[model samples]
Target: MSTPARRFDTDVLVVGAGPAGLAAALHARARGLRVAVLDPRVAPIDKACGEGLMPGALAGLRGLGVTVTGQPIAGIRYLASGSCAEARFRAGPGAGVRRTDLAAALSTAAQDRGVQVHRATAGPVTQDADGVTVAGIRARYLIAADGLHSPVRRGLGLDAPVRGAPRWGLRRHFPVAPWTDLVEVHWSRHAEAYVTPVGPGQVGVAVLSGVRGSFDDHLAAFASLADRLAGVPGTPVRGAGPLRQRARRRVAGRVLLVGDAAGYVDALTGEGIAVALAGAAAAVDCLARDRPQEYEAAWTAATRRYRWLTAGLLAASRVTPVRRALVPAASALPAVFGGVVDALAGHSDGGRTTSARTRWHHLEGAR
Candidate 1:
C-alpha cells in the first residue's frame, strides 16, 4: 500500500536550492518567516557560466549575507576581431568566483539561517488556495527557484512565455594560469568565448554560441587562449546545455520565480547573480505583505531591466561581418569598449546621476 501523505506547516516553501532558492529562503528566515527549500541537487549546483561577478551583482551579494573575496579586474578586455582595450571595473567592486563556489556559499548561508532544506531527486508539486504540497509536506507559501526548466512553473501553468534570442553555454577549466585579471571576451562570427581568471592558478572559459555541437569543438574557436589553458595543472573543461534567454512572467499566485527560472540572458552581461539576489529580496517583501501586485511589480522591474541590457549587448556583438573584426574594434576603442564593460561590471549608473530610470536607458543603448 502507498504511504499516507505527510503534513506540516511553514510560512514558505521554496523549490530548487540554487542561488535563487537559497537567497529566497535566507531572506524569508531573516524576516521571521519559517521557510524550507527543496531541490533535487544536494549542493554546489554547477552550470556553464562566465563566472565573473559584475559590480552591481557584488553589492547585491553583500545584502544577501554572502561575502565575495579577491581583487577586482581593472576593467573588461575585448578580443573580438583582434581588438584589445582594458576598461576599469565600473561598479564599486567585482570578483571572479566559480559557479560551484557561489552555490556552495549560498547553500551554507541558507542552512545557517535555520531554513529546512530537502534534497529530492524528483516529485510533484500540488497547490490550492490554502497552501502547496511538494512530495507531501504542506506550506502556506511556495516559490519556484528551480532553474530554467521549472516543474513548479509548469504545474502552475505559467509556462509558454519567453523572450529574446536563444543560445547555448559550454564551460571548462583550463589547467593553466589565467592570462589576465580582466575578463577576456573573444568574439567570433559563430560563437563568443569568455575567459575569466578565477585566481592565480586557474581560469574558467565559457563559449556562448548559436550553434549546436560538442563542447570540445566549441573550444577550438578560442585557440588564442591555448597557451594559457595549458598552464593550469588541474583545470577540467565542462559544458552547459541550451539556456532560454527570457521568460514571460516571474510571479504567479503563491508561486514566484527567481534566478534562471524567472528569466535568463546570455552570460555576456554578467548580471545573473545580481538580478537573482535582487529579485529574491523583493520576493521577501512581496511575500511579507502577501501582495500579488507588489510581487508582480518587483519581478517586472528586475527581469525587465536585465532583458533590456542583454538586448543591447547582443546587438553590439554583431557590428562586424567577420568575428576577427569585432575584437580589433573593441581593442581600439577603450572608452566606448570600457563603457560597455563598465555596464557589465555594474558601473552603468555612473554613481552621482545613476538612477533606475537612467540605468534602464543606459541598458537600452547596449541593444
Candidate 2:
C-alpha cells in the first residue's frame, strides 16, 4: 500500500507571529482564504528595534484596521560632530511605538479578523507542488516571515551569503520625556544611536554598530545623548544581530518569504515595517491569484528603493570620513537630504507608484 498524502488544514500557513507574518495572515484572511499562523512566542512579542514607524508604515497598519497607540513623530533629525540636519515628513507624521505595543495591536487585529494563531514553533518545512507542511500542519502555501535569521528560509536552502562587516543593534527604554518630536539619529565614529519617543514618559534608544560591545559602551560614543539619559531608569537591553541578511530567492516550491526573511540590507533607514507590510500584502495577493512566481518580481519592485538606498548609506558609513561628515553634509545640502528622507519615507515616485492592489490587479489581468 502507498503512503497517504497529507491534507491541507488551512489555505495558508504563516510561519512566525511578528508583524510580517501576522500581516500576511490578515491579508490572506481578508481575501477569503483560510489562514493559520504559527510561532512559539506568546502574544505581544518584543524585539530590539528603533521603534519609529514611518508615515507609510503607519498608513499600512491603519489600512489593515490595526491601531497602534504611541507618540507622534514628525520628522528625522541627524546629529553628528556637533552638527544637526532635520527633515520633516511632507506626507504625514509617523509613530514611535514600542515593539510589544505594535505586536499586540497586530495580534488583536488578526484575532478580530478570525485569523487563527498557533503558539507553536514551525519545526520543519516540507513543500511540494500542491502544498507545504510544518509543525504537523499542512497548508496550500507557506509564508516565511520568521525574521532576520529565518529558519524556514534556511531550511529551504534559500539563504544567501552576505558580504562586508556584520552589524548589530541593541535597544533599551528610558523613563524620560522626549525632548523633540523628531526621531533622532545620533551618529558616532563606530556606531549610530536612534532615539524615538514611544510614550509620553518613555523613549527607546537603539544603537547600531559593526563592533560588538555593551549597550552602555555604544551609548558612550554619543556624549551629549548619554548625558541627557544619564541616571534615567531604563528597561533591560534587547538586541538583534548581523543586521544584514540575504535570501537567494524569496520563493521556494510552495513557500514564499516576507519581511526580513525575504532579505535585508540594513536598518539604517528605518524602513523595515513599511517594506515588510508591503511584502506581506504582495505575498497574499500573489497567493490569492495562484501566481506565486509573480511574488518574487513584485517584492523586488516594492523594495528596490529601500535596498539600494540603504545599501548605499551602509557602504558610506563604513568609511570613517564619510561617516563623520554625514550630518554636516546633510545640513549643507538640505534639498538632497530631504529628498533622501522622503524616498526612505515611501513618498518617492518609485517607492509609492505601485500599490499592492494595483499589483494584484496586474497579476489578475495577466492571468
Candidate 3:
C-alpha cells in the first residue's frame, strides 16, 4: 500500500539562520506562531565581528533566550593618534562571545522552542501573500533575516534604507592578554582596529577604516599587542569586505525582514547583533498583533537615527584636524562624550545628544 503525502505548514518562515534569523525564529515562537527557519549553513555560521555586544544587545539576547558566556564589558575605550578616552557607566554591561558560538547557542534555543529549521545548500524562496514555497514546504508569512547581501531582500525588490560609505574589515583571533575590560577602538592614519577579549586567554581584533589586507598583515601595526600573542599562536583569520549600511522598506508584505536583511548599521559601532536581535523581537510583535506594517516604523525608530550618528562619526574620522580637535575635547569631558556614546550604544529612546555630546568639549574643555 502507498503512503499518503505529508504536508508541512507554519505561521512564519525565516530565511538565513544567523543571529538575526535565529532571533526572529525565537521571537516568532514566543508570540505563539509556528515558525520555519532556512539557512545554508548547518548549525553555526562563522562571522567576522568584534565579538562585543552592547548593553542594548544584552537585553535583546535575554529576550530571545540566548545567553552570552563572559563578563560584561563595563564601557568603551576610544583611541586616536594622540589621545585616548574611556567611557564607563555604572549600569551598562558588555559581554564577549565568538560569533559562531553565539549563533549556535541562539539556533539551539530557537529549536528547543519548536521552530522548524532547515539547512539547505541552496533553494531559493518564493514568497506570496498566502505563503512561502521552498522546495516543497509552505509557510503563511516569510521573513528575510539574511546578511548584507541577502538574496531574499533582492527577490523582494527592496533596497536598503541607508547606504554606508565604503570600508573594509579584517578580523582575526590572537592569544593575548586582556588589554582592557572594555571594547577598545584604536584609530590610526591607515586603519582603525577594535579589540575585545572574547575568551579567558583570547582576544579578537577587527581592523576597519583604510587599507584592505589579510588578518596577518592587518595585525602588523600593533607590534606591542602582537607580542603578547607570540606565547599563544594566532588562530585562523576571517575577513568581511567593505560593508554597506542599508535598510529596506516594506520589510513586511505578508513577510518580514529582520537583522541585516531588514537593515544594517556600520560595524564601526559594534551593535549589529543587538540591532538584529531587537529588530527580530519588534517584527514578532507586529506579526502577533496582526499589524506587520508596524515593523518598518518600529525598526527605523530603533536603528535609523543610530545609523545617522555613525555616519557623522565616520565623517569625523576622515578629517585629521577634526579628529585631533575632537579627541582631547571629548576625553576631557566624559559625561558629554560618554552620553553620546551611550546614545549610540542604544541607551536613549528618541533624542540623540550627538551635538551636545560632541560639542561639550568646545563648551567646557577648550578653557
Candidate 4:
C-alpha cells in the first residue's frame, strides 16, 4: 500500500510578521492563493530602525492598500567633519514613519484582505517533495521573512558567515520639532547617527556603530546632534545588532527566504523597507508562476544595485581617510551625488541609459 499524502492548511505559509512577511501574505492572497501568516508576536510589532521610507517603498505600500501617514521627507543630507552634502529625491518624496504605526497599518491591511494571521511560533520545519510543514501547519510553500538572525534560515542551513566588523543599530525617539525635512546622517569617527522626522513634533535618532556601547555613549560622539537633542524628553532605547547578515541562497526546495532573512548588508543607505518589499513581491511572483527556483535570480536582479552600493559604502566607511572624505566628495560632485541619491530612491529613466547610469552611480560610490 502507498503512504498517505499530507494535507495543506494553506497554499502559502509566511513566517514572521514584519513588513516583508505581511507583504508576502498580501501579495500571495492577491494572486488568489490561500495565504496564512505565522508569527509568535501579536500585531503592531516595533523594531529599531531608521524608520525612513524611500519614495519607492511608499509607492509599494500604497500598492498593497496600506496607508501610513508621517512626516514627508524630500531628500537626504550627509554631514561629516563640519561639511555637508544634500540631494533631493528626483522621483518623489519619502516618509518618516514610526515602526509601530507602520506595523499597525500593514496588520490592518492584511486583516482586511482576508489573510489569516496566527499568533504561534514556527518550529521544526519539515518539507517533502510535495509541501512544507511547520508548527502543525502544512503549506505548498513557506516564506521565511524571520529577520536578520532568522531561526528559519539557520534551520534550513542557509546561514553564511558574515565577514568584517559586526555593526549594530540603536534607536530612540525624541519629542521635539523636526529641524528639516531631509533625513540627516551625521558621521563621526566610529559611528553614524541617522535623524529622521517621524512626525511634526517627534524625531527618531538611530545610531549605527561597530563598537558596543549604550545609546547615550554612541550619541555623545556626535557633538552637534547631541547638543541639539540635549535636555529633550525621549523614549526608551531599542536596539538591533550585527547589521550585515548573509545567506547561502534564497531558495531551498519548497521554501524561500525574503527580507533580512534572505540577506542584508548595511542600513547606511536606508533602503531596508524598499528592498524587503521588492523581495516579497519577487518571491510571491515566482511562487505564483509555480517556479520557486526562479526566485533567487529574480531577487538578485531586483536588489543588485542596492547590494553593490551598500557593500561598497560599507567597505569605504571602514577605512579612515575614505570615511573622512565621503561628504566632501559628494559635495564636490553635486550632480553625481544627486544621481546616486536618485538611484537609491528607485528612480529609473528606463532603457539602456538607466542601466548605464546605474553602473556609473555604483562605480562612483565604490571608488
For each candidate, C-alpha RMSD in Å?
Answer: 8.0, 4.5, 10.1, 7.8
TM-score of each: 0.85, 0.93, 0.85, 0.93
Tens-digit lDDT track of model 2 for 242-347: 9999999998878999999999999999999998988898898888888899999989988888888899999998999888889999999999999987876752
lDDT of each: 0.69, 0.87, 0.70, 0.88
**Cα shift from native, residue 204, model 4 (Å):** 0.3
4-80: candidate 4 lDDT, tens digit per residue: 32367888999999999998887786666778999989789999999999988887777666789999999999998
- Model 2's alpha-carbon lDDT is 0.87
TM-score ranking, high to low? 2, 4, 3, 1
Pairs with steric clashes in candidate 4: none
lDDT (10s digit) by residue, model 3, range 1-367: 0111133377777888888787777766665567888886778788888888887776666655567787457788877655878887555777878888888788778767788887763266676655567656677667778778777777767775444347778788876667678887776665677888887777888888656666666666656545555556767777775577454584646777777776554687787876676677677777767678787888887676667877677778777787666667788887988887787565332221222223323433554
**Model 3, C-alpha of 63: deviation from truth (Å):** 2.1
**Candidate 2 clashes between residue pairs 3 or more apart in a chain or in different chains:** none
Task: Let me know the TM-score candidate 4 reaches against the reference structure.
Answer: 0.93
Whole-model lDDT for model 1 versus the true structure? 0.69
- Model 1 poorest 10 in a row by lDDT: 348-357
Ranking by lDDT: 4, 2, 3, 1
How many clashes (backbone N, Cα, C below 3 Å) per candidate?
Answer: 26, 0, 4, 0
